[model samples]
Target: MMTSSIVQRVSECFIKPLHPIEDSKQISYLTGWDIAMSSMHYIQKGLLFKKPTTSPNNQQDFIESLLKKLKYSLSHALFHFYPLSGRLVTHKTQHPPSYTIFVDCSNNNPGARFIYATADVTISDILSPVDVPPIVESFFDLNKAINHDGHTMPLLSIQVTELVDGVFIGCSLNHCIGDGTSFWNFFNIWSEIFQSQSCENENDVPISRLPFHYRWFLQGYGPPISLPFKHHEEFISRYESPNFRDRFFHFTPESIVKLKAKANKEFNTTKISSFQALSAHVWRCVTRARGLTNDQKTSCKLAINNRLRLEPPLPQEYFGNTVDVVSAEMTVDELLQNNLGWAAWKVNVAVVNHDDKQVRKMLKEWLESPVVYQLGRHFDPQSITVSSSPRFNMYGNEFGMGKAMAVLSGYANKFDGNVSSYQGYEHGSIDLALTLTPNAMRALELDEQFVNIVV
Candidate 1:
């Protein structure tokens, strides 16, 4: 657990107007999509630090110093310093969507933060493990601590666990503020500041002065662009009641290599990669495991950053949401009948030239639809939030400790099979974290063909 003094001190350094975006600005033609893409909220990556020797006695003080330096470093990173214009839809009482941070000082490790908390901060965990699997132990503990409901932090938590080796630092952030690429950009800067290799200055923050035009976009685009209600109950439920879920899975390197090799052969395209194949394959696995038939239609919403694809790629420092979703739809039959390669092919079709006019219009309509408009506002962190995009993996996000072994959303807030894939894992295969209903998981296992292959 961390101390209030340290939290307070760090808060004092970071909680101020580190970056501000005026509500009146209008985003440029392509940039408007950037803000819209970023509007989709998710959790930032989970970070693990080797327990420092000085931590045992003055644990809290050490944490405070680290946080103060972290905040100062973030203030210098271009991504953290940009402005936001996605706040037009927020309720008056809600805090503006710049960078909001929350903290949890609980006695027990909760393991995940997207759901409601059932415990409190009376004392630290007595049953804490002495030898945790270095990264995994700190990862789970931090989730348990920071995801607690009463507290919300812009920078998730700087958790101190009772490890045999030493104290480990766990840091998290909310994705609504920045993507993994942007987060790493800030982290690299933060590391330099920590080492005193770079000096902090107000000008170090990026200029997020891009024009924002929600009103104009809504006015210029009509009908589907204005979220429509197909049914009152489903439409209203998004606001009346919201649901979210998340879950994680572990895979050895061998499993991923087999899947990738199979995908490559099946697709008849050596260029077809694991992310494309596995994401499609898993979507098929889970959707099928959930008993969705081929006749039914489902959409695979993938995030595509418009930063470089736009007429003029957004300024490297232009930090508001600059992503858009490229979705692919298939009948359950088509998905069920196809091999991983077929699925990969379909995914390739959906993602290639993803920003094409028809595809963009379709995506715009879905986001503007009444169900999404209402539900997105009341989205529950505990409910499943799916982000299968590999942009985070493609972006160079190494801090001093080295690139993250795996990264999950700090804001996903649920255990319902919210899935993510990361680069540089144990070996040839990819590693993924997924949240799935217990029943669905069991069903997959009970089905001999699917179960025997992966396990």
Candidate 2:
């Protein structure tokens, strides 16, 4: 059952760029990375901030002013990340019933949707529970929105929920626009602008870095190739997540160091990374929790950043998706029979071998005869794909308020097997969030092998 309390909407409006390009209309074609992600869920993340003052009087007035300051800063931020303000435009073809996708910045009024809402809860009301409270889901603006919804919906949406003692700034951006790197780029600038306004040296704060707008594609392949499928319906299916729950497991720095040391002890070569060690551990624990047979097949899907893998590497600030996922698979008998280093080595090989040559080959195959991805399309029960990176700077996004108390996500694109990882507030720590079936969740909570290392 859903929570009884719900957020009440106060007002809504769209915030356009403060400085728009004049005379010329801008258009950008969606790259292969963008096209594939365009069919997935919007990336939803939120920052929790404690109120600045302790006064109990005129609280609503304070919140009103804070909202005004945020929107103003957002408008300025949109000037640089203008593609996010533009909506996704599609061209329809009746003969074969297909559509071509692109972002159009020519609209008279293009902007991100800003929403304000209030909830009767406190910060403790959220962080006190072992599992994420359902009310936390209400803070996000785009509840069930997917990237394909960009055709008619706002490319970016912000929902600020006023709580009794704090504020939750939830954001939703189309995955097609960019990945985590791009998201943080815009957010960091927004905070810098906001903080400068409160200081006497307002003009002293300058944007640390500007984002590059070029999209990624294969070397020989041209841009914006059409999908072999006739309609988007064939590529996407309805998502039903009525029976899943989200849980966050915090892994401390000490545990990670131990895990890494244990993994490296095997194979006699200390090459396995911390990520590989932890991923392998999680894969083994989950496989056991699910109670599969010894012969059952299991697979793990992990995304490798291709920015550095290309012949001519892309800029660090390149503001588009340069991500591609690879699978590390094995049977349950082999996986469980092996030691920590063996499984970690398997993951390492998959990541290390996905070089420029291999990536180009895969890209060529997709372009020539597009593979209709079905088995792993919708939370394939046999596979697990880690969504976000632990390297992203999540704790540094301080928007005039103090550092974030915690980082949370909204209810978008969440299925039984989807996973998202975040950098913890403490150095060398990681926070892992997962959406799993009720049975699996209970089993995981009781599994001593996994719980011994978690904080």
Candidate 3:
């Protein structure tokens, strides 16, 4: 529902990269995990900030200075995360004839795209309520923000929107290159360089952890599996449901505590964590809202970060995708009829089952018969995909201006049954942003359990 009228002319658009890579044509093969994500849409992250109280004597000078710093620091950050300043290349001439993909990290390739534009909106326009603001989509250029063509779409695209009293920094990165952790790692480093005002001496900055880019670690004990293009096509078709809408729901600390206690009392068990309790409550409410048959099976799919769960933990900075999906399913009647604690227990069990051995087994199985997109087959109107983590310091990302007033998901085209979570602007609170079919969303808004917990 956003229109182009919201965004003014583009002030600038160009490619930014670190110092030229020595080899202009080096190729890096993607892991099975990366190939699986390649078919999905780009991951969009946005940070909004209020206008600085103190500025240069002139307005134009202030804007120019800010842009210069952003571009410079971003280029320097690319030095540490080099694969981002490249493109995804699909090989059509493999011996066995499969769509093999790899990262073309050559210096000659177009680096990350940087765009500057002006917007005729304010921070309040987008973040006034807990619900997702309509203008959120208008804050960035979606058409060019994510390159659909693997050959030409820059691996990363950054769009900065200058507003009357705020700024919106939007980043779109190919999911195949890295997951949310990798994206935020690059973002935090960029902010560090910008805040330090030391683009020239970026090397002098001490990095607590450096990214590990050798993806061979993900390979398991088996011949490489062939990932076919047809799989992605089928994956897309499965979730192409109609009348979906995106909305955000806020849960204050007090509500979360109360929900946890209530869930525990339901089954007389005290082990459910906040995440489990909350996810269970939401899953139950959503299923009820969808009006599924009692005998139908409903599932909740959670993306578990395997960084720490691996037997020998991956390097803190292993920069590629290290997430594995863990799902819990129950008949619609059981999910609806059970107490909150029963649902939470099911969720907890699903997570606990994903131990190191299970993680390795899953990876090995993926290697034997690789399917890039894993969620579509089990995904339906009765399913939910939960991503992002409240533990990530989304609000701490600060450029020279100040900390972000709000963090947003740039990829709002999320289908129904998709949920993303983040730390709330207010401490001790959690924000749950979800996309659901229009009727389901409307029913959820009126549901007593949801209304009681939502702020």
Score each candidate by Cα lDDT: 0.42, 0.80, 0.76
Which stretches of candidate 2 lie above 4 Å from their native place?
22-25, 94-98, 198-205, 371-378
Q: Could you tell me which residue pairs clash in candidate 2?
A: none
How well is each residue in 90-134 modelled by candidate 1, as lDDT tens digits?
111223312211111111212222211112121123123221122
Put down candidate 3 lDDT per residue, 1-455, tens digits, no spaces: 23444676576565646577657436777776776674466778889988776554656777777888898888877877888888767655445556566788888777888888887776776776545765676555443232224567777778898887888898888777888888787787778777776545656455556778877445443123355543235333323335557767889999999989988888788888888899999999999889889999898889888888887788757888888889999899999888899999899899999988998888877776766563345457678878888877688778767778888875433767988988898888998988888788889989998898897
Q: Model 1's lDDT to the true fold?
A: 0.42
Instruction: Give the best candidate by TM-score.
Output: 2
Candidate 2 CA-lDDT value = 0.80
Q: Tell me each candidate's TM-score.
A: 0.60, 0.94, 0.90
Evaluate residue 362 in candidate 3 and report its C-alpha lDDT on the 0 to 100 scale: 88
- Could you tell me the TM-score of candidate 2? 0.94
Better of 1 and 2 by TM-score: 2
Please state the error at residue 22 of candidate 1 in Å: 13
Query: Considering only N, C-alpha and C atoms within 3 Å, which residue pairs clash in candidate 3?
Result: 36-372
Of the pair 2 and 3, which is ahead by TM-score? 2
Q: Determine which window of 10 residues in candidate 1 has minimal summed lDDT.
A: 114-123
Q: Clashes per prediction?
A: 50, 0, 1
Model 1 spans > 4 angstroms off: 1-42, 58-61, 78-80, 84-181, 195-246, 251-257, 312-318, 353-408, 411-417, 427-429, 445-455
